[model samples]
Target: MTVPVVYSACEAYPTVRFVIATQPVASSLFVNPPQNLTVVGVDVKQRYKGTHGIWRLMGDLRREYAIDAFIDLHDVIRTHIMGVYCRMHGIPMSRIDKGRSEKRELTRETGKNLHPLISTRQRYFDAFKRMGFDFGETFTSVYPTGADTTLFADITKPKSGGERWIAIAPFAKHEGKIYPPGLMSLVVDTLSQRAGTRLFLFGGGGYERDILEEWACEHPHNVTSLAGKRYGFAKELALLSHCDVMLSMDSANMHLASLVELPVVSVWGATHPYCGFTGWHQNPANEVQTDLPCRPCSVFGNKPCQRGDYACLRGIDYHAIVQRLDNVINQR
Candidate 1:
């Protein structure tokens, strides 16, 4: 999520020469970053304690590049350590305002009136504003050039008279966010029956692979499974970009699809987009969610259902979602 936001800043302000300090995992996420952006991988596992973080940067990049200011957007205890290093080095710095108070109101159990909070992307821009940079542009995802179409093989793009390609990513990190598998099977079955429609199932893990494989075998020619293929991100991202529409849980796929500007029919379970985690430039109108009183019980959908039954998710009508997808597909 934060990846695109930082990319936008670097893209919008090409003259700034933004040096992005992040965990080592980021090295995999932002492959072939733009000219102005330089990602410095910090050993997050080390906790940046003792002689790590700002101290390390101060000794190396600071001496070489003549460093000026610091902006710690994470604002976590770990990043705070970097801020301390900035102060000791006499470099000016600012941290992003996470909009904690607004988020609190959106997620609170009692006396809650739900409304959209400040977007995480906007907050990143606001962080830049504090550093005397005003970025008025919207967020966009960056992908490798000439994204291979061959990896998709028989799953072609939607032609004027050809198949409408659909990617179904029906898993989230937690059970709270996942739509019922039986219900998702119905979505696959209905869509697969349509003339010139190809359904591709996307997910990871052996268990997810088994599930997708079973569905693919059941449907035969129309359904193909992309799970557990280990195609690597560069290939998967290109393949994802080829899709016409992505039916997904409110997980990474929503944001991943947004990068390619592919429209998403995201099913919300325990987490609401109102908490400011919606994908870059994704329309809220396309979102599929019921307005249950206990809609957003957890920010990340990792919490156990306080109601025990998880009415927030089980109560959602899958048929309604299918109808909505029909509408979205026609518009596309």
Candidate 2:
């Protein structure tokens, strides 16, 4: 989505080139990206380690691209340090407005505010706008041409008859945001019984694999687990393009599904969509959540529930998720 957001700036100023500085691992997500845009793979863990590293990065950027302006969407302590380097170089720059105060109101334990905050993308657009590179809506995050289909050919087969494919991402980095594994398995078991539907379990290559694989084995004919697969990001993206709808927690998978312009039925827990983390152009109606006063107890779902039990998550019945999935599948 950052590529698309910045690509709009490239459109407005045809002479301009964009240096999309990202973590080394994530650079693979872009395949044959725009000619005007250069994706710089930065290793914050290795190459750019401290203040000295940031200074080196600044020098490299100047020497490599002779770039005049900087827009920092990643408003972290590290990026702030990098912005200082940009200032020292006499470069014009704009950092993102994270709307921390607005986010606070939404996540507070007492007298919670339910109004939506300005979206992260809107802030990105605004940051570029501050640099006088005004642009319109972002482009879809679809893969560029020349993707290798063979990567998924052996692992994934064509849908038989009027079959519909559903991708279920049942894990989040913070357990507070994810539905319980046992309950999610129940959701999978129920969905597997649906006539003309096939389930695909998605997760990172870790302990998440064990849980996802267990659910997949139970419905061997109808389910497949993509966790810890050797296939790269581009291929995983290509596979997601074929899913009818992504059933996900408010996590990266939901955002990834949106990148391919796929419909997502996202389940919300401690993190509310109102906090501006909703997937790109996803319908608010598709958000499945139990409405409680303390609904959005945390912003990123990293904080523990003050109520002792995480009723916000554990209280969500398995049937509710399945029913919502049924509606999303039929409506789409």
Candidate 3:
């Protein structure tokens, strides 16, 4: 008989259906797939707010799906509540220890010489194996569907209109994660001097959007700030998809650009790709980051650098990045 499993997290559930749970967890679980699955999403924010209600929802879902097993990709207190509820109902469940992964990354960032461990992608698979699912391959996958595409308009903008374009994503969830604005401007100015090249900014509305506008005003005709403009993630993806290349700090846009298969020049500050959250869908050969002693200051880049200098990002050689960009764009 086919095993009945319910997979749930906050996002990305359609792809990973087996033993699914609600949002965040759902989203993380959807990154991997297993046979005989039913996916569910619990739309909880990253921060804890509606956690008390999660158990009630999970209880309802369990009865509805006759959920045999619960796979908690999100191991928060809320998930713990669900685990307790599942036990009360005599339903077997397993949880992926994301906190341990975070701790491992933190240890590595703090100059601790931990033995080289499995990739983040592999760790997810290993989590499943603990619950009796055996899978191989450690790389994360991103498959954009029609629903994801519907976020953008169908019109293709011309890239050859006497302008060499470089896409810039300046905003990330954390402030320290961004490359310093002065440095960003310097890179844009240096690159704009190349014939037919211009800078196209991509991001949502906020303080960073204001910064992009200020940069655009300073550069006038060369820099176009589209940060707060009318464009969905799909449109942004489509636009970045056509650009010769992209320059981004560590953020969701980095992942989005990767999905479009864009050659990205990533700036690493508080976080590092070795933590396993690097380009999920892009070519590994194209990622550019600094190898600093104080690099990878955090797992999610939520904290400021302990040292005031932020040398990991501030110390990056602009010339080297430009050279790498030349190689990537020329080959494309």
Candidate 4:
């Protein structure tokens, strides 16, 4: 989600050399960043273990990169410690206003204030503005010319003239956000039956690979499973740019597709778009979710369903999801 925002910042302040520190797992997404941007993969849990470790990490970053002012996008404890280090050194700093109270109101069980809050991307832009940096949204696609399509040539073939390519990311980190497998299989079955329609299933892990493989086997000619293929995010982005639409949960895949300006048909379960985690430049009309009062019970969809039935997800008609995809594909 922060990928495009940081990229925009880099473009806005061309004179400033921006250094981004993120988890190692996410570093792959920063492969071909702007010239002014440098990404450093930080193993926070392994290397920066304690307050002292974070303090030391700050010093290392400062000395190594000639640090000046600090803009803390993540206001977690580690970033708080980093702010302290900067203040102690007389380095100016600013942090994001996470809108904690507003988010609480949006997610609370009773009297929920469900209007959309400020977007996470907007919050990031505001943070930079508070630090006296000015910029507009100049980002378009990571692969301006388009991603190197040759990377996955083995599995993906050139799109035919009438082919409607669709990508489906059926898994999220939490169970609350996942569409029921039996229903998802029905979706795959229905979509693959259409003439000149190609379905690509995206995921990772052996369990996900097993499921995707089974689905691909069911629709041998139309469905291709990319799970556990070991192709990095760059390659995935390459493939995504060619797709007409992506079907995903409230997960990273939605944002990844957004980076390339691909339309997304996102499924929301325990988490709602009102939490301000919607994909960058995505249309709210394309979001497939039910209007249950207990919707958005968790901010990240990590919490167990309070009602023990996950009615918020189950109540959503799979046919509505298919229709949403149809609209997106036909419109394109």
Candidate 5:
């Protein structure tokens, strides 16, 4: 999500060097970045372990790059600690305004303010603007021509002109955001029956891999599972760039597909797009969600359903999702 904003910043200020520090796992997403942008992976778990490690990281950044200013996209305790280091050094800094109060009211159990809020992407852009930088939206597909996927020959074959490729990322970090497995399987079965349509399942973790593999086995001819393949972000994004459309929850995969300018048919439950996490330039017509007063109970979909039934997700018709995907893919 932040990837696009950073890309725009780099493009807007070509003469200024922009170094992006992010998690090691996410560094690969910065494929074909602008020459002015340098992405560095910080291994917070291993190299930057705790408070002391964060302090060391600050020292290293100043010593190595002579950073002119610090911007905190993620305003957690770790980032705050880094801010402290910048303050001590008399370096200018800014942090993203997350609109926590607005988010809380939007997700309150009752009397929810359901209007759309500033998007996370916009927040990132605003953070840069506060630091006296200006830019318009300058991001497009990460793969301008097409991604080179020659290394993935075993899992993927050459794309045929008649084939319609669809990528499905069925898992989310939270149960509230996930569709029911049985119903999702129904959707899979229905789509598998379509002519000239191939499905690729994307996910991670042992349990998710098992489920994806099972679906692939069930639809042996049309479906392929890429879960647990350990392809990493760069290769996965390459594969996704070739896909006509992606079906995913409001998870990292949705954002990943968006980075490649692939349209996503996103499903929402406990999380609402009004909370401003929608994929960049995705059509709202493709969002499959149920309308309920108790909706958007959590910002990240991490909270358990207060109604205990999760009617927001359960009430959604699987056929609606299938219809939306067909509309997007066939129109393309």
Candidate 6:
């Protein structure tokens, strides 16, 4: 007797492609490959410009790629619009519900009403499930491809004398989530006291990079800035993988470090781990965030602290982080 086989679109359709409509930050987190995924980075400016243009682009994507199924990793207004287009075109669509976990925690923490049950990664996976893919079976690590690896060759250069180094990703896309330069300086200084360890800073060149560079100059022997170093995401990963550990803000670096399997000392400010975006792919060796009542004011951090004081981050003692790093370095 012959056995019957069932095939979903993802399986039946050998040419499975993914259209990732998300911001750069979110796309950096959601975009994965070897499953034949194609990411269409939603240009923030273009999407914000006009509703019709955004819809038109969605239509174009639908017609152009003949996209089998659409996954809105970002379930915001823009993605909603695109999802509608996909549906109108008779294409199945899925969106990850990112708010469920946060909603649960918020109700418990603030004594507020339960919002909803959703999670960022879960919502993303839901899109696949809609097309007959099991979330558990399909779940895979987000990895950099050959192109990505090629991009980071320069920055991932081996250190002289085969010395081990610690990477510091101090700059966050949002200023509110960034630790103050003075506080970071203290952390770097404390870490520098440990011999045989080198410090390399990672970030794009900007005012924050300038500030970090100034701090690095103060401790020239132990610290150096690799912020402006021309490396792509893949190269950054390579450099991150080479590090003994990473000290980073609660930003994309946390996710990236997880992908590289580096031990991360994540410093939190306006954000908290309960948001579910914390170090999903990396080992979080230490999480340094003040237990402030006003912590996690928003799901995504804002420009300034909502309560003016920014106690969530400002209250975090620099000494605590130093002690954690000391323990990590001094461990037998």
Highest TM-score: give the candidate number.
5
Task: Show model 4 residue runs off by greater than 4 Å.
Answer: none
lDDT of 6 by residue, 56-134 (tens): 7777776777767766655678778887877787877777666655554653446544332343454545655665665
lDDT string for model 2 (1-332, tens) is: 56557666766777788888888877876655666888899887777888888778878888999999889998998789889988887899999999999899889989887888888878889999899888786566666443355657867876566888899999998967988888888888888988888998999877899888888888899899989886777777777877788899999888888777778888888899888888888888888888888879899999987786878888888887877777877886
TM-score per prediction, in order, is: 0.88, 0.94, 0.73, 0.96, 0.98, 0.78
Task: Go through the candidates in order and give each one's C-alpha lDDT.
Answer: 0.78, 0.82, 0.64, 0.90, 0.90, 0.64
Write one digit per residue (lDDT tens) for candidate 1, span 24-45.
7555567457788787777745
- The candidate 1 region of ten consecutive residues with least summed lDDT is 151-160
Task: Please give the lDDT score for candidate 4.
Answer: 0.90
Instruction: Please state the error at residue 164 of candidate 6 in Å.
Output: 2.6
Best by lDDT: 5
Task: Write down the TM-score for model 6.
Answer: 0.78
lDDT of 3 at 59: 65
Ranking by TM-score: 5, 4, 2, 1, 6, 3
lDDT of 4 by residue, 1-332 (tens): 77888888898888899988878888889857999998988887777778987987898899899899999999999999999999999999999998999988888888888888898999999999998997888887888777666855776877889889999999999999999888898899999999999999999978999999999999999999999997888888888999999999999999999989999999999999989999989999999998888877888888889899988888888899999999998888
How many steric clashes does model 1 contain?
Answer: 0
- Candidate no. 1 TM-score: 0.88
Which lDDT value does model 6 have at 184? 78
User: Which window of ten consecutive residues has the lowest lDDT sum in model 5?
Assistant: 146-155
> Residue 245 of candidate 2: its Cα lDDT?
88
Cα lDDT, model 4, residue 171: 92
- Candidate 5 ranges with C-alpha deviation above 4 Å: none
In candidate 4 the C-alpha lDDT for residue 182 amounts to 83
RMSD of 2: 1.9
**What residue pairs are clashing in model 1?**
none
